[model samples]
Target: MSARSIALDHLGGAEAAASLVSGQLDDLLIDTDLPRPGTIYRAIADRPVKGQGGMFVRTPDGPAFLRQVKGLAPGQPILVQVTGYAEPGKALPVTARLLFKSRYAIVTPEAPGLNLSRGIKDEDLRDSLLEIAHDALGGQEIGLILRSACADADPDAVAEDIRAMHDLARAVLADAAGQGPEKLVEGDGPHTLAWRDWVEPADVACRPGSFATLGVLDQVEALRRAEVALPGGGSCYIEPTRALVAVDVNTGGDTSPAAGLKANLAMARDLPRQLRLRGLGGQITLDLAPMPKKDRRAFETALRAAFRADPVETALAGWSPLGHFELQRKRDRLPLTDVM
Candidate 1:
């Protein structure tokens, strides 16, 4: 995917914002004033609470829990990165992996094989990055993820920057070790970093009520609607339950056999786009208008082709005995409605 447009709309609350990328509602950022997930913080290690899998840490934001730690003791300063937000009535999940995120790369000292860049497709560029990271780390195991921005950047510049980032991460780690309790080192939230890497700054144009003008607000509202009209004459009813997302395709008022087939084909093409745009995940059951058994294979082929551009991993499990097409997509994050 090429660089896309991004717009940040202030939600009238402190540090709260809504981000739109490529005309899609990509992320919702809520500011709790506490370090959001993906942030690295320093805290004073405390004794593990009884029955809890993680140890307690005294942070500047408040007392937080480090879910994954080793060789830690009370009063010892520890470095932890927030991996997950505190669920309702739950403690935050943190880890010892210190991450340094830039617009084009993510550097970490713990994971050496992890590469997160989606933009570097050229083999030479990839090799160059690996060599640079290897040299910068001085044989120390580290992880580097190059973002889309690095796809066209100068290799030398990227190498220098990665080296600088490595040094910075090391400094931070040293500081966390030396600094005493209650000190917090904040890092960028996941949403902020996502927008930074995916959306080009030059393409951004901020305006009042931009979200509404760009149809972001309307698109979100439409996701909650039960039915969506197709291009030709059919309609699709989407019902998301606890078990899975059920989608029923109907011919509406068009009763002709040809029209029904056409509508089914249109629904087949549009369903995957809808799923991606809405960020719907998990098991999906597409109930199309019943057709001849011979035509099912052709319809399945078309359906698979429609999902060729989807970034999320999806698998077509073939049609069910009841004639519904079954599919499952990996869930990377919560649905749009739940996040909103």
Candidate 2:
């Protein structure tokens, strides 16, 4: 397995980067004041959308669209969680269902159940985690999910994490009935996110200037450009426009018959990390280097496997009639330019 590590330090406020010992930045998070996902807000309902069945709600950030809600009068209070980042100058996307996510546990108010991450397959470990969950939940009706990182973690530490998340969930739920528009919970910043999501075992450097020491600063600086160098001599340019994000694959100087296939496969596997680092999303069109139709299935399989491990929610919309591949990704992270 590739050795993973996280380097965290302040650039403007807070910045963190994850790398796989390949001298390339796998993920980058910069602290921005924008309302982040997983933040709960006690919002006041505004007018409903004409035909979308979603109601607009007033929030500290701006007007956030609350989905799947009905029968809302003007200026009614409701608790909602930010689902993801919204497009520029658009309504912030929100959902009625709230989930409190943390490093080792996730508290679900609506979904009542004790669950373990699917990656935790060891029966003995599962039993131990179940015991810990039962103790922390204290028979609460709310749900608790033990994340994969809890598999081999210290029992006490895991219990503490579970209790912390559970308490936060309870507190947020209690404030749901409060009056007017209010910010209930602030979202995690880059340093917090590094600890919560970069769960792989690795060295951590959190002191001042750790980013420079770990070469994370250099890797992050490269993300400002659109061109991404792929394995072998291949390259891809990731350009974001108002309408969509476009990628162009190039096979460089390789002249072999399988060169296109090789380059395209390399690009597919690395595209998720590139996008994650750069924080680009929404409609993506990939103009791949010319490859055989017979190899399309293999290329698709590679892309699917690559994205399966990515934390971002992306829909591989498949190939267009013009032979370009398409994807729709969530705007979970702000664009690097916006945050940098």
Candidate 3:
């Protein structure tokens, strides 16, 4: 068959992986409820590219795929692909093809109540179903990705699909419903990328190249607006927090008398904008580091004066003996991810 860029939406767990491979399924997509640090594609792709949901592996040989995942909780029945190629594009990694063939893609009443309704209860039901599928159905011990729209899916549509799937499942279940363990259970879906609009952050940049470089510049700008500057001439340390963030300043190489209070004040005054652009929230602390007593007092006075320019409930208490200035701001949401 000619290669096409097929994208599999809710391709559940390990068993699903096996089935797809057995059938020589095209591109796959996976989802995760929690942040994934590492993934399996690295262990299996023709060329794996990490994305938000999971890693994607593609080759001219076949299709790119995504996987679905839930946050790993304690004791959850884990569905790992039992057998597969150690390398990319291998046929049916595990399980027997004859067993999978006629019955490979059947669907059954997987967690009926869960599939039937809305709200948190449905979620619980779905999870329970996944457990049953794994423990009872020779299911490849995989889980499902429940979509938000499922809560609102039309009952008729859901029923129709479920019935069609259940029929197929009955056929498969006949020979091995409770027979020797199988590798997977086909999942439910009229899957599409429609909900991406709601979950993705509009402000966070996910460009192809160096967005990190832009992030660094943005951080420097925030500080500049706060009028924070180096003493001799170095850089600042900024720690982002969910509630607020802290910035530490170190004078680099300037050491000139003119670079004293004027520079420090400049850095302190300009930093807030950078905070906003970076979507930094929470309390902020500034440690100016040690300086000549005279320069310290001047820098402090200049900092207090700058706060008045765009005063927004931001308060800069004069430096502590440790040369730290503290700022507290109320936070309504989480902070940005990039570190400056």
Candidate 4:
């Protein structure tokens, strides 16, 4: 993965734009202008008030509700991440689980354990990266989640990113203490965080009509076309309900001997991408084309491998008795459809 050129084009409407770029053999339709999942913000802590699940603080953006967490006081300034969008006339929910985002890796204050390489498959290299992050942070309570881009990055580069995030967290805290109520210390709005220090100057570019013309339009099309055609001759229909997201696959006209197998494999690869691109999260049920019992194990293995590449944490619960694939992905923000 070389340094790819990124151009931001604002379509027309407020903050309407998309990032057009070819990466890893795929054309990623990223909404660069919108506040995405995992973005950090600086907010003033209002008087803590009891809420359904936790304490709530009113910020300039909106009301940010949290659980009964500590280390907070009324009139105190703090940083938060947009966990989910609030319903109309409802309070927006936020989390203190700070994350430092970069193209190469994401640094979080939460440490699940000593396994710094929680998702990486290579045991030896995992241990090595873990040691690097540990040493770079100097025992700071933080963890690193290397992005797919790190697969080709140098060890030194990874270490540098981890250290940078640690420094960034300190800077954010210092900046928050002096910030006025509802004033943005970083980023374009109180909902977003600025990464001007970490972002390479040469990598940034501006273009008009990128968001409005491309991102918003693409989002409208994706929601309208709930059913998407697969690579070969199959199709997958996405149904979003209040309870969970359900996807059903059909092997259109491909009646070959391995039609079911092929469709299932294609779906395994495409579904994760679709979920990320569309910002779909929480429980998901995939109804794949039926295959022979003997081949079921292989199908599951392929599905797991495909999902392993997702940036978010996903759990595959294997196949259900109804022959559907059950899974869950962590929800960090509103779905793309809702954001648009």
- The prediction achieving the highest TM-score against the true structure is 2
TM-score of 4: 0.65
For residues 74-134, write the lDDT of model 3, one tens digit per residue: 2222222212112223332221111111111123223232222233366665564434334
Off by over 4 Å in 4: 1-7, 12-53, 68-79, 84-91, 103-168, 175-223
How far does residue 4 in candidate 3 sit from its true spot (Å)? Answer: 47
TM-score of 1: 0.64
Error of 1 at 38 (Å): 3.2
Candidate 2 wrong stretches, greater than 4 Å? none
Can you give the lDDT of residue 238 in candidate 4? 83
Error of 2 at 50 (Å): 1.8
lDDT of 2 by residue, 231-340 (tens): 88989999999999999999998989999999999999999988888898999999999999999999999999999999999999999999999999998988888777
TM-score to true structure, per model: 0.64, 0.96, 0.30, 0.65
lDDT of 4 by residue, 101-135 (tens): 66555766665333333446777776677677678
Write down the RMSD of candidate 3 (Cα, Å).
18.6
Instruction: Report the CA-based lDDT of candidate 4 relative to the real structure.
Output: 0.62
User: Which candidate, 1 or 4, has the higher TM-score?
Assistant: 4
**Every model's Cα RMSD, please?**
5.7, 1.6, 18.6, 6.3
**Candidate 1 lDDT tens digits, 1-340:** 4344455564434332444556655544444554566666777887787565579887766677887466777888888777655544555667777778776667867776747365567888777777766776678766777666777677776677777777777777778766655444566643465455454443553676666676666766777687989867789898888789999888888877666667778888877667755557789998887677788877887888888855568899987888888999865334545555
lDDT of each: 0.68, 0.87, 0.37, 0.62
